[model samples]
Target chain A: AQTVTQSQPEMSVQEAETVTLSCTYDTSESDYYLFWYKQPPSRQMILVIRQEAYKQQNATENRFSVNFQKAAKSFSLKISDSQLGDAAMYFCAYNANNAGNMLTFGGGTRLMVKP
Target chain B: DVKVTQSSRYLVKRTGEKVFLECVQDMDHENMFWYRQDPGLGLRLIYFSYDVKMKEKGDIPEGYSVSREKKERFSLILESASTNQTSMYLCASRYPGPYNEQFFGPGTRLTVL
Candidate 1:
C-alpha cells in the first residue's frame, strides 16, 4: 500500500510571489508517477502537472513545476508568480506504473494567494 | 477535451433512504472510479469499474455499492443512507493505460439527514 503525506494543511502566498507545497510518499516501486491536482471552491478538479519517476529532470509547466526526489520519496509542487486563480486546494497523488492502478492522494494543502 | 459529469451537484436525503449517484463520461473511457471527498481527508476511493459489468472494491467500499451496466456510466448506490455517508462524491474516468490521466467530474455533494 502506498501512502502520500502532505504535512501542511494550509499555505498562503502573496500574489506574484512563489510558493512551494510539500509532499512525501511511501512506495517500493521504482517506476511510478507523481501528480499535482488543483480544485477550486465548488469547481472541478484539474491536473496541474505530472512527473515520471524515471525522468531525472523536474517537470515544469508554465508557472507550475515539481521537485521530484525519488530517493527521498519526496515530490513537491512549486508555483511561481502565483495569482488569485492559484488559490485552491492542491493535492499530491501517486500512481504506480501498472494498469488499472488507482491514484493514492495526500491529505491536500489549501493554497491561498493573497493580493 | 474529456468531460465527466455527475448526475447532481447537490442532493439531500433522509436516513434509510435509497440513494443513487450517477456519473457519465463523454469520452469512451474503459475505466471509471467513484470517490468521496471530505475536509482534511482529501479523497477516498469507494469503487471502480474497469469495464461494463466489472467492478472492483477500492480503499473504502463499505457502506457503498456500485453498478456499471454501461461502459460510459458508473453509478454509486447507498442502500441505506446514513449520516456518515454524507459527503462530496466525485466521479472520474480514464482510458485504459498506465500513464493516462484520470478526468474528474464536478462532484455531487450529498447530505443525509
Candidate 2:
C-alpha cells in the first residue's frame, strides 16, 4: 500500500510572495509519478504540476515548481509570486505500478493568500 | 479542451433513500473515476471504470456502487444513502496509459439528511 502525507493542515502567504507546501509519501515502487492539484472555492480541481520519478530535474510550470527528492521520498510544491487566486486546497498525489491509473492523495493543505 | 460534467452541482437526500450521481466526459477517454472528498481528507476513490461495463472498487468502496453502460458516462449509486455518505463527489476521466493527467468535473455536493 502507498500513502501520501501532507502534514500542514493550513498555510498562509502574502500576495506576491513565495510559499512552499510540503509533501511526503511512502511507496515501495521505484518508478512512479507525483502530482500537485489545486482546488479552489469553485470546487474544481486543477492540475498545478507533475514530476516523473525518473527525472532528476525538478518540474516547473510558470510560477509553480516542485522540489522532488526521490531518495528522501519528498515532493514539495513551491509557489512563487503567489496571488490571491493561488489560495486553495493543495493536494499531493502519487501513482505507481499496478495502481490501475488511480491516484493516492494526501490529506491536503488549505492555503490562504493575504493581500 | 477536455470537459467532464456532473448531472447536478448540489443534491439533498434523506437517509435510506436511493441516490444516483451521474458523470459524463467529452474527451473520449477510456478511463473514468469516482471520488469523494471531505474536510481534511483529500480525495478518496470510490469506484472506477476502465471500459464500458467494467468497474473496479477503489480505496473506499463500501456503501457505494457504480454503473457504466457507456464509455463516456459513469454513475455512482448509494443504495441506501446514509449521513456518513454526505460529501462532495467528483468525476474524472483520462487516457488508458500511465502518467496521463486526469481531467476532473466541477463536483457534486451531496447531503444526506
Candidate 3:
C-alpha cells in the first residue's frame, strides 16, 4: 500500500509571494505518478500539476511547479506569484502504474492567500 | 472537456434511510470511482467500477454498495444510512490507461441526521 503525507495542515502566503507545500509518499514501485489537486470553496477538484516518477526534471505549469525527488520519496508543490484566488485546499496524490487508476491522497494542506 | 456530474449537490436524510447517489460521465470513460471526503481524512475511495456491471471494492466499502448497469452511469447506495456516513461524496472518472488524469464532479454533501 502507498501512503502520501502532507505534514502541514494549513499554510498562508501573502499576495504576489511564493509558497511551497511539502508532500512525501511511500511506494516500492518504480513507476508511478504524482499529482497536486486544488479544491476551492465551490467544492470542485481541479488538477494543479503532475509529475512522472521516471522523469528527473520537475513538472512546471505556469505558476505551479513540483519539486520531485524520487530518491527521497518527496514531491512538493510550489506556487509562485500567488493570488487571492489561489486559496484552496491542496491535495497530494500518488498512483502506481499497476494500481488500476486508484489514487492515494495525502491529508491535504489548506492554503490561504493574504492580501 | 471531460465532465463528471453528480445527481445532487446537497442531500439530507435520516438515519436508517436508504440513500442513492447517482453519477454520470459524458466522456465515456471505462473507469468510475466514488469517494468520500472529510476534514483531516482527505479522500477515501468507497467503490469503483472498471466497466459496465463490473465493480470493485476500494479502501472503504463498508456500509456502501455500488451499481454500474450502464457504462456512463454509476450509482452509490447506502442500504441503511448512518450518521457516520455523512460526508461530501465525490464522483470521478478516468480512462483505463497508464497515468491518465481523473476528472471529478462538483461533489454531493450528504447529511445524515
What's the lDDT for residue B52 in model 1? Answer: 97
User: What TM-score, to 2 decimal places, does chain A of model 1 have?
Assistant: 0.97
Cα RMSD of predicted structure 1: 0.9
TM-score of the candidate numbered 3? 0.98
All models: lDDT?
Answer: 0.93, 0.94, 0.94
- TM-score, every prediction: 0.98, 0.98, 0.98
Interface DockQ of each model: 0.69, 0.71, 0.69
Model 1 Cα interface RMS deviation (Å)? 1.5
Q: Compose the digit string of candidate 2's lDDT tens values, residues A1-115.
A: 8999999999999999999999999999998999999999986798899998999999999999999999899999999999999999999999995666779999999999999
Q: What does candidate 3's lDDT look like per residue over A1-115, in tens digits?
A: 8899999999999999999999999999999999999999886798999988889999999999999999999999999999999999999999998887689999999999999
- Worst lDDT 10-window in candidate 3 chain B: B94-103
Docking class of 2: medium
Chain B TM-score by candidate, in order shown: 0.97, 0.98, 0.98
Clash-forming residue pairs, model 1: none
lDDT of 1 by residue, A52-97 (tens): 8999999999999999999999999999999999999999998899
Write down the DockQ of candidate 1.
Answer: 0.69
Reference-based lDDT, residue A84, model 2:
96
lDDT digits (tens) for residues B1-113 of candidate 1: 99999999999999999999999998999999999999888899999999999999999999999999998899999999999999999999998765778899999999999
Minimum summed lDDT over a 10-residue window in model 2 chain B is located at: B94-103
Which residue segments of model 3 deviate by more than 4 Å?
none
